[model samples]
Target: MWLPLLVKRLNQVDMQKKGLQLTAEEIYDINNASLKDAIVQFGGFCTGEFISKEGLLLTNHHCGYDAIAARSTPQADYLTNGFWAASRDKELSNPGLFVDILVRMEDVTGKVLEGINAQTPEAERAKLVSERMKALAAEAKGPENYVTYVRDFFAGNEFYLFVYERYNDVRLVGTPPNAIGKFGGDTDNWMWPRQTGDFSMFRVYADANNKPAAYSPNNKPYQPKKHLPINIGGVEEGDFSMVFGFPGRTQRFMTSEGLKLAVETSNPARVKLRGKRLEILKADMDKSDAVRLKYASEYASVSNYWKYFQGQNAGVKRMKTVEGKVENEAKYNQWASADANRKAMYGNVLADINKGYADQKEYTLSQVYLGEAALAPAAAKFALNFVPLQKALKENKADDIKKATDAIKEASKEYFEGFNVPTDEKLFAAMYQMYYNDVPKSQHPDIFKTVETKYKGNWNKFAAEAYKKTFLTSPEKLNAFLAKPSLKTLENDLIFKTVNSVYNNYLTNINPKLQAARSSMDKATRLYIAGLREMQSDKVFYPDANSTLRLSYGSVKDYEPRDGVHYSYYTTAQGILEKEDPKDEEFIVPQKLIDLIKAKDFGRYADKNGELPVNFITDNDITGGNSGSPVINGRGELIGLAFDGNWEAMSGDLVYDKDYKRCINVDARYVLFVIDKFAGAGHLVNEMTLVTTPSPNASTASTSAEAAKADVLENVKPAVDSKTKVKIKKEERKAKAKMKK
Candidate 1:
């Protein structure tokens, strides 16, 4: 191999610090069209580094974990301790995860510009392009959905089309159990001193035909052309670095209004909703050891963000509204004063974007709620039966009776598990009391009197009747009375439409009103965008990551917490002991791990600081999408896997705090320690051609089988597959748009 095992590739040096932020393509030497195939999206994840011949595909650990977690059984712990197959036969399969390979690039610029161009109105353009892109995607037939994107540039003046191939050859290879993977749990999720290894391993399986195929025992791992070698020299301040992964989400660039709303109402509402869900999550997780283990990731995932929102909300609250008049007057005066700037395509900029922002605001805010309150809350109902059904439909109310009966009959079959009787009874009683207390009797005289006369303010009796009326009611009585099967089926159903209906009603009515304030703010966003464009155009700032593949760089730096707050830069074998509090669930260390800590045999895996630690913290700017990303140095050497940021940096969800926000990564050294020292698997370690000559006196005894994986950026090369070259011969354009200077 031309690439050495340890030495940083000379070509991979810090290109940016040499005053080269622009790619050769930008200077017109490299055609953007030629690179189209290299840019692709997978499971909403953007991908790069086409032709991964190294058989080693790099993505976020969280990206692979979902697949592994889906296949995980209680008997085999995968996420915490780590997974190493004795051979290929033991590899687990999952559907959701896939390593997308960008195979070809197609520049359909002319086709894209056929009906829409600089002259096209943004509204009409959106409509035309939406249909056009779908049509383009439809005309495609292949192993994967062909990704097509319309790139708008130079203030939306230019547009281009990018197409890519997605590979479904992903398989779980190895992973540490939850203990090491999710060390800090919810408490340390978004904060620094972050100790977590949010990484999962998977191998890409290419079919016998050497293309993506359905899962099979016969499939082989798709080797990539290049796999990053490990570099544990440890990143220091001012060192060049880059990250490559499927970052899930980022809100870096937004209308100041959108940012405000995020930092304010939207984030808070989500936090409140999640807070409620967590309360239940905590209870359920606490009660059962199996469920706790089974749903560890789900719980920690939410907790990570619960802290994020708390910090985000704090950032939002800390930002007091400035004087609108003064701010606007100054902004307007500045814009008006810049005659030269206004003359350059400024005439129609305002009116041109007037409706688009209006069109995109709700959708922008809608993005925030898609998973949390909207889906997660629904998933949380332990069983369908737990759904709080409305009290018996009145005999006189035929519509209500039929509605209730129909819902129960539908849910009774295959939908709900048995209702949680105790939880339901207690919850419904509290809910009924809360409802009765909040609304006036005068508003609903009939119902109020019924509530008063029968239940007589006794929440228990009221709740019991409602619970019985829905799922608990005997089928014989229920069928006789309401044209339905015995509702006994609902006793097992955890989901209830009654609860869903109420929740939807609240989301529908309350959200629209709340959304208007956000919409109004989105309209004023032009001012913000314009202000930002003016301010930061000189810096090489990419669009706030949209769960796309991006590179964020910073160095290892530790901070002094509040006077009494305790923290360390590289947690040691000792951190395991510091976290030995028995009462605190977050601090529970396994006995074996505690023993390891007590023994203090870090071996060669220990940093010069001498500790084969479990996890380490850093200040790299990372977020959801950045999860499982390989933290690399300026030489593009892998150092650690960015798993979580510190709690203080949780505020980084919306705002990137250079000072306080740090990317929490599972140090390469620790990852190696766990693999070698704890697992004692030498086979996996022997696979990697050892590249590094660590200090002979260093702690090799503590070093684990994962040492080969540590600082893994140098020598690994993926096996390459030769395929047909994508052919796109551009025809000369006569009715073409003029190229901008």
Candidate 2:
């Protein structure tokens, strides 16, 4: 059986138990309209779902952070106070944001595997597969707006083609204050028992005919074929749930040596480097509101992965991830040795992998340090721009120089907006020192020699002198220099010379060694993966995730992380107040939220216990690109938004541990509560079609009215106060009118 059949069986059992009464076709059917149409790739980076027929979309707050940051100012701190579009006309337009919806997918394995297989050389096989994919993709192309690409699966043993349509005009609808949406910040990120709302709302607009178009005032909200109906019924333990989205990557088939490199070197280096960088940025941000708003997105982006790396390394060691891979390798080797044909096909896989790691480790570490050190300094990074200017100056064309200079002038405003010279100087000194000490002397970049000779190995003095002399540090000075456009000045520039010295050495010395080692490792991996599939012929193996649309299913269940520590499946708003600290930037609780919680003003969004549910956890397998994926019950009704993974499962991207792996999701009720009660955006709520339950399966649902009423009654209702009761009644009446199809 294929992976789809296994998933179907899992869903079939789940639906029967949870009263969802849904079939596979309802979730993913090419012949009929299905729930798949409602899910779209948000901003080409995260997953999102359509909530309203008018294209009101829901995604995680962090997914929309960059756009929100772009629209933010100190005077109008949307990041801090929250934002609500009083009406569609008032919603802010996000210029570079867009959504992609998968039109369809088809297996192209037969076409991709036309050439000689076992006998063909690895390089030849790759070329043949690539050519076939390109040809198939070309044949599938239909319209200018639609995109097509082919993906490799099961280690190039399988291939599939996917077609998608793009929607460009996505606009901000509403968002909760950072204190609510990003409640626990880095401290609580990836840790369970969380209270973060972690949700955001946007709307997609199309042309008059409801076709994709550029942003225009006259565009209307996209009328989608299917939009998920919001189920007010909260989830319970062992309830059937599934997540459909684009998971970025998962190296499930990596060898032991690779895991060792990550645990020993890569993870620690990244965490240390980002820690210093974040400290520098946070200091400046705390001192000024202007700096805070300006660097908010950048700081968040850096810290998110910084913490992830730390947890990942710890998890790797705790779980003995490398040992597990070694065991798998041993099994593969045993299987290979038992048969002559198998041995011939995969004999040298393990030795080649080990050799590659041995050869590539030192260079890889050097490359990582170079990125964290030389590239970490703002002045050093900005200096690379002058290389293009230098090339243009050599051309001696007026237009070329003008174009290059104008580009630099245009980029200056944004470059300097969040930058603090003194903060970056400190970062430069620290990072430079770390780089010098971490990497072996032979692998050290040539610039370190200059530092040792000129400044007597004092990174602080070198940093001070470099910043004082670099024109790139000040936008005004850079802009002035750009006007004259002198090549001689650029050649003599200290920052440029320093960067070029390191960069040129990396290109000439370090990169060649890395490439040769990586090539050997890749070839061995490809062969090993193919051999593994052959050995496990009785079972169907799915491909590793590569930023393609995939469906994963599981249930909402609590997990025991360690000895005597059984974490619950969900967290409540009460936890927010419990974790509150005014002095801490991460756990600062908003007074409005605090007052509401204290007064028990849950309105009509509280659970049966009269408490507001904040976040929940599930076993639905997901990764980076699945950040804003909708967590749907078996009936395909949206119940929550997946935002993070538990700290115990940070190594999941490399190896999925079902026992410890859990996806953290923002409960749908909490998201709506923040939008209506907290942000006071009732009109936005009116746009969605909220249902007590998803339409039951046609085959299993009872025809009697009594049975339908009983099913609806089984789902808990949110408590309504006098004011909230009236508001909900008005919304119910409106929904009833809209349902008159």
lDDT of 1 by residue, 354-402 (tens): 3444444444334344344333432223223233333443233557656
What are the lDDT figures for the candidates, one per model? 0.49, 0.81
Query: Which residues of candidate 1, in runs, are more than 4 Å off?
Result: 1-69, 72-83, 103-122, 135-164, 233-238, 316-333, 336-541, 560-569, 613-619, 693-741
Find the candidate with the highest TM-score and give its number: 2
- TM-score per prediction, in order, is 0.68, 0.89
Clashes of each: 83, 0
RMSD of 2: 8.1
Q: Compared with the true structure, what per-residue lDDT tens digits does model 2 show for residues 191-260?
A: 8778898988999999998888999999999988899988876667777778888888888888899888
Q: After superposition, how far is residue 15 of candidate 2 from its true place, in Å?
A: 7.6
The candidate maximizing lDDT is: 2
